[model samples]
Target: MTTTTHALAAPPDLGALYRRAVLSGLSGFLRRGGDLPNTTLELPAVTTDVEHLGAYARVCGFRLRDELPATYPHVLAFPLSVQLMADPSFPFPLPGLVHVRNQITQFRPLMVDEVFALRVRMADLRPHERGQQFDVVAEAVVAHQVVWRDVSTYLRRTGGRGGPRGDVRREAPEPSGLWRVPADVGLRYAAVSGDRNPIHLNRFAARAFGFPRAIAHGMWTKARCLTAFEGRLPDALLVDVHFRAPVPLPSRVAFSAHADASGWLFALHDPRRGKPHLTGSINLI
Candidate 1:
């Protein structure tokens, strides 16, 4: 399919994009379509903010360093993805979409001062048991070479015929460590990441969506896991994860991981109930 590209001269205004998302969500019922827009949004000559990177590291438990975390590119490319989804031609509202899975591939570690270009697009709309699912693909290109890429899968709840589940059941391993996730984690992460979804920021807002309280961002959980493997991961690698359940703020969760020749398998779970919050693996590329 032919794809149309929009080049942004400056970083997108996330606040404006979020306002559009809220309006789109409020009138989502009026939308009637299943097709994704065949368009790509590009932001060129992007550079990192040192202060913001430090803040992001603090919130996600990554040690401050000159090299960017594997998940960092997602943070940079997120605004483009938001712009693509907020377009009137997009089918689903951005507010209620569930982040069901994420897979990121880092060809090599990115340095803190390096400049890159970001490109984002939507693809692969398909049926799910409870709704429809689609992918938002983002890439970070440095000096004309693609250095990092990520595919974030989101589910939009609507009527649908049942489909096969992608997750596989596995026994929970013994805890390697325990984390006391703070209640303000969502707020802190949002300050740096620019993802201020109501379901992750306030109790009353979350209640409006049937959640008991605000939940931690899925990307935060993924980043925290990578933090645990810091200094041990390969320079080129792939991390794939399936989000299993919401982690209510101010909750305690257990983390576990086992290493092999290929890479590492890791998970975060409820310490008491043994219910997984996230399950994933990191493999050398």
Candidate 2:
């Protein structure tokens, strides 16, 4: 496969990229191909803004610190992923793509002042039991070394069969904590994360997408789960999570975490229904 690369001087405006994504969704219906684009987008140098970082930390429940959180790089690279998925050559519409899974491997904790390069590409297009899935892989580099990487798997619901089922059945664990997720949590996170997906913003918008009410962003749940292990996690480690069900806005949810020899297993579930919302694990590297 021949890969084409495009490098930008700075990060693209996420607002503009989001507009393109919505327009692409409308044009996607006329698209007839089923092949993923073999392309990559890169930002040569990127650094964190202290205010932005603080706002993000507050929203995700992380303490403000010099060292960046494990999930922070994803925020930096997200616009590039949006650009890739919104391109005309891409196979899927960006608006409805569901982020079903995410894996982040941090080689070492990155500092707030460090400058890093970012590269994002699409890969691993395959079938799923309910739809087709692909990976948006992003990497953060400093001094020619990859310091952090993330693979976010998005599912495009196209109605397929005989593919692997992504769901895992597990009994709900005892609650370690209870959280009262506010109705505007999605909007708050979106303000910082640039993920203003309609399904997460307002009830009216969510209804257009077939959701009863606005839902929380999946990444927010993952970040919130990590907050429980803040200052306790290894510097170099892997965090993997599967989004099981959406957490509706203004809901009560339970969080559980168990530790063993290798690492920690964690999950967020609906306490009343005994249904899992997000299940994840962390492994020391």
Best by lDDT: 1
Model 2 C-alpha lDDT per residue in residues 146-265, reported as the tens digit of each score: 999999998888776332235575554699999999998999999999888889999998899778999999999999999999878988999999998899999999999899687998
Provide the lowest-lDDT 10-residue window in model 2.
Answer: 161-170
Q: Point out where model 2 deviates above 4 Å.
A: 160-172
Worst 10 residues of 1 by lDDT: 160-169
What is candidate 1's lDDT per residue for 1-285, written digit by digit as tens? 899998999878999999999999899887886689999889888898999999899999899988999998898888888998898899988887888899999998889989888899999999887888999999999989989999999998886543213576556578999999999999999998999999899999999988899999999999999999998887899999999888999899999999867788899999999988999989899
All models, RMSD in angstroms: 1.9, 2.0
Full-model lDDT for every candidate: 0.89, 0.88
State every prediction's TM-score relative to the real structure. 0.96, 0.95
lDDT of 2: 0.88
> Candidate 1 regions off by >4 Å?
160-165
Clashes of each: 0, 0
